[model samples]
Structure formats: structure tokens, C-alpha cells
Target: MKLLLFVSLLAAAYAHGDCGGDCLKACRSCTCDLPNDGPSTDDGESPFQIGNKYSGDCKQLICKDHNASLIVDGKIYDRLVCFQGAWHFGYPEFLEEASSAMCLNPGNRTCPDDAEMRYEDDFKCMCKPDFEDMSDVFPDAPEDILPLCTNCGKKKLRITFLIDNSGSMASVIHEIKHFIGQLVKFLKVSETGNNIAVVSSAFSYDVLINWGEQSHDESAIHDAVDSIDADGQSYLATGLEAVKAALVQPTDENTQHKLVVFTDGSIKCGPEALKSLARAANNLEHLKVETFVVATNSRYTTRLHAIANGVEDNVFSISSEEDDEMENLKVAAKLQRRICA
Candidate 1:
């Protein structure tokens, strides 16, 4: 009975020691040094020089001895690691030959012949395996344990303005400029890293502001918006194509993209062409279009809504007689909620 009890306690202790806690998710830096010949002190006479020390969470205190031995303590230890508020020597150390793995941040340091730097966590530098199933999201997991890493991609926002530059829009050009100024101000006040771009639709199309443009210089964008001239025919399809050309799908899996179209008068494209164009635009799963009709004329309202994916909330209209200040305020508020949300 006494022997059985002792064996049970030893097994329990062994099981508890097996918990290595969290492994390091990334590697910061590593170096190796050896001592040189001569009566040199430990200050600068190491044969192999210590490069930058590990600046990651798994920090270590190592001692280089007179015999050019590298270990945690001068001659007694391997590597000292602090785990669970207690220091354990030689238990968990940086993976050997780590340079052969796929290093995420391989700063000028060279790893062993075949080792490479791999992804990081919080414990030690792990190496990429010999073979991995790229389709498997957690391919790095050992057969006994669950996978530790998964990609949680980024989210991005893109805002685009499609404005009409036809002759009839001359009276409201100033109002458009003011609306743009307010929009820029709102973006600045919100402090979200949203992308901004502008497309002018008139006799010929021009992307005055390209996509991925930031809001750093408000004056430059304001000048571009204010410089729009009311001239030529309202070619809505032309402008839409220009916008499509300027757009790029972000590498991340998810994004929020908003395109606001402000146009007056009729589009130059025929019904068949308009229908084709609207279908193509709607097919873009990651992009949503919103229309702001500068006129209440029936000639453009129904057709314009089609371009806006036939969503009523996404379609807004403001006529020449409407109060410009109130209309701008409403539109700006709606935009803030939709784009910045």
C-alpha cells in the first residue's frame, strides 16, 4: 500500500510538470558568442560575439564562461526561462537551427543552415514544418494538441464620390463644394483610417482623386472638389466605369466599400447599356453603391435607383429648391453612420 501511494504521487507530479504553458508566438532576436585566446576579461574577448539579445517576451540571462561555453549559467545551465512566476533552467529554449523556417521578421541575423524563422506566439521561436497543407487553417498543430495559430485578417473602409459636371449643375456646384468640405471635416473629426476618392462625370471622365488617398491635406482635396466645372453631357456609365477601374479588392478577406453617386440630368447610355452596367456593378459582392440625385426629375430617379442596387435607403435625392444646408447635414450624417460604422 505504501509503495502504490508513492508511485501515484510521482505520476501526478510528472503530469503537472508536463504543462509547459504558452509557447512563444514570435521571435525577436538571438545571438551566439564564443571566447577568444589571450588573458582577456569577459567584457570584449569572447571568440563568438553576442549580437542583439532576445528582445521578446521569452527573455533570458546567459553567461559566457572562460572555456567559451554558452549556456544559461556560466557552466551549469542550458537556458533559463521564466515561466509562471518561477525561473526554470534549460526547460524551454529557442528552437535550434531556427533560420531554416519561414521567418516573419528576419532582421540581418542568419540562422543555422536549414532552420528558418516561423510565426510567433509568446514562448519560443518555432520552425516551419517540413510539409504543410496550405488549405488547412491550422496546419502547424501537433497530433496530440490543437492548432495554435489562425489568420484573423484586417478590415478596411473605402469612400468614393461620383459627382456630375453637366451644364445644369452650375447653380449647385458651390453647394457640392461645401458638402465635400463638410464630409472631409467629418472624416478628420472621426479619426478613422478610411480611404477617399473622387470621380468627376462630364463631357469626359476624370478620376480627380484616386483610391487609397488619405485625408492628411484637406486643402488639396477641397481644391480638387471646388475645381469641378459644369460642362458637357451627363455620361453616368462612363463615370461608373472609371470608378470600377480605380477600385482594388483589399488583400484582407473583409472590407466595407461605399460609392456615392451625385448626378443631375439624364445619362448618355441607353436603357440596355444602363441595365447591363447596373447588373455588373451589383455583382461586385464587396462594393455597395449609393445614389444622390441632384434633381427630382422622373427622368433620372427610377433609373438612378437601379444603379444604386435598387435599395431605397441607399438612394437619396435633393432638388435645386431644397434647403442646401439641411440636405447636406442629412447626407453627411447618414454617410458617417454607414461608412464609419
Candidate 2:
């Protein structure tokens, strides 16, 4: 009876002002601080609170400071938010909580367990190297019961790279090399064996890009990129088939697979390649993989646009005029996310 009476008194006091007016008993807010977190921005630090915690959506990937960005689907959004003449995301708990959590403590053998802080990004929590602002917070989830949502960060993501390793690619091989190198740098790698599988087919004489490597070590891909020399016919059909096969591996409603084709011209591929692309599209009609084509020149624009996006909803086009090296890397990163499956 004494305990029950004490509990009643505590509840009454809490309602008065202990938790603040309009604050829920759960000590959380239903609305996330807009601009507090999202896809791209610079600083990841902000001083905003709606109820008792963060003021942003957990679905928005958390980044360190405002220097980070977010990759949605296959497109990248940079510096999308502005705050107080600067940029930020969620809050910088590390600097503030790290000390209390003993993360900054030099030799505090025993510390409070509640002091332990979350670094924000899911990949980082798993001890994976930081890249692409991959954190495990389901920001899309409605607030209030947000804690119930699991932000594993990475979802099903499938990406396929179609290349034109013909002689023309030789001229741009260095540029491609730089692009691939930086790709491995900015994109996050899969820690749970979920990564990007690059099924590439080149065109010079016939076509040779698929290594049948369903899932090779991400490390190996950076090395394999060195072998991309120009000399082959543009048989894009063969490449398209390879991508279709890769997309067939995943079996989950969460799967997000994509096929990206990079080519220069239709001189070598001709009608055969077109037929294969069309068939590939038909194959992915109900499958998880959605195809995309990135042709280098206008020669096969019509066919590439047609074949890459059959009946599926999403597709993209990039001009050789604009540097797509980083964009391609983003594609690879998303594909790697799918590969994590």
C-alpha cells in the first residue's frame, strides 16, 4: 500500500513538470527535427530537440557532422539541409556523451552502462569502416514508438555495371580507374557479407565482362578493375544476361537490386545486343532487380533507354559530358548493399 501510494505521488509530480509540459511519459517526440538529419549535408552536429530527444526522422541516414551525404535509391543528394548559417545532422552525442560514456576516459575501468553511446551509423556500430552514412535507424518509422523499429541501416540493394571495354574505353580507362578507386573509398563495404557484385561485360570483338563471380571479395574487384583494357565488340546483350542472372539470387521483399549498363556505342552489339537487353528487361518484370543503362554516346541512346527500363518503374541516364565516376561508385555501393543479402 505504501509503494502504491508513492507511485501515485510520483506520477502526479511527473505530470506537473518533472518531464516538461506536453512531453510524453515515454520521453520522446513524434516529429523528427527536419534538417536535423537527412541524406546530405556537411556538419553532423546540431542542438535541436522536439520532446526529449532528437528532432529528426530516424529513417534519414545519420552522418558524422555536416560533411556527410546520403544515397537514396541510386541518386546522391549533397548539402540538402542548412542550419543557423551552417549544416548539421541529429546531434553530436559523441563529444558530449563520449566523455561520460568513458569513450573519452583514459582509464576509467568501471563506468555506468547507460553512459554507452550510439555512434549513429549502423555500419560503424558493427565496427565496419565508415562510408555512405550507413546507420541503423529506421527514420521512416513514425516517432513515439521509434525505439521499436530496427535500423539495420542497409536494406536489399542490387546494382549491375555494364561497361564498354572496347578500344574507346582504353582512351578513358584511366578515368574509369580513378573512378573505381574512389568508389571503393566513399562507398561502405558489407560487413555481414552483404556487398556489391560487379558483373561487367565489355565489347571489342565479341564481348567479355562477366567473370561469373557471383560474389567476389570487394578487395578483389578493385584489383580486377585493372584488367579493363580496351579491345572488344559491344555485345551488350551478353552483359545484360549476366546482370539478370545476378539479380535472381535474392529472395526477400526487402531486396533492392539494380542493373546499370555503361556503354559507348552500338557498333558492335547491333540487333543482338538489343534483343538481349529487351529479354533481360522481361526477365526482371517480377524480379527484384530493376535495370538501368549508362551509355557513353548518342549512338545507342534509343536502344539503351528502351532496353534498360522495360516495364519497371526506375531508370537513369548520365551524360559523358558530366563526370559520372562518383555516380557510378554510388551505384556500386547500392549494389553492394544488395549483395549483402
The clash numbers for all candidates, in the given order, read: 26, 38
Off by over 4 Å in 2: 1-153, 156-158, 184-186, 203-216, 246-255, 267-273, 310-341
| CA lDDT, every model vs. true structure | 0.49, 0.42
lDDT of 2 by residue, 141-215 (tens): 222211221112344244445565766666666665555554444333444423455555554222223333433
Local lDDT at 80 for model 1 = 40
Candidate 1 local lDDT, 1-341, one digit each (tens): 64564464345334433232232222111121122222334354422322115322233333334233232222223334333333334433222221111102223433221223332331222223532221233243233222222111111456677788887777877777776675555554212445667789877788887653333356767777888988887767667767766653432345456677766546666777677657645654334443443333446667777766666666655544445565554455445444443
Q: Where is the poorest 10-residue window by lDDT in model 2?
A: 94-103
lDDT of 2 at 2: 45
Provide the global lDDT of candidate 2 against the true structure. 0.42
What's the C-alpha lDDT at position 170 in model 1? Answer: 79
Stretches > 4 Å off in candidate 1: 1-156, 189-192, 212-215, 249-254, 283-299, 321-323
Q: Scored by Cα lDDT, where does model 1 land?
A: 0.49
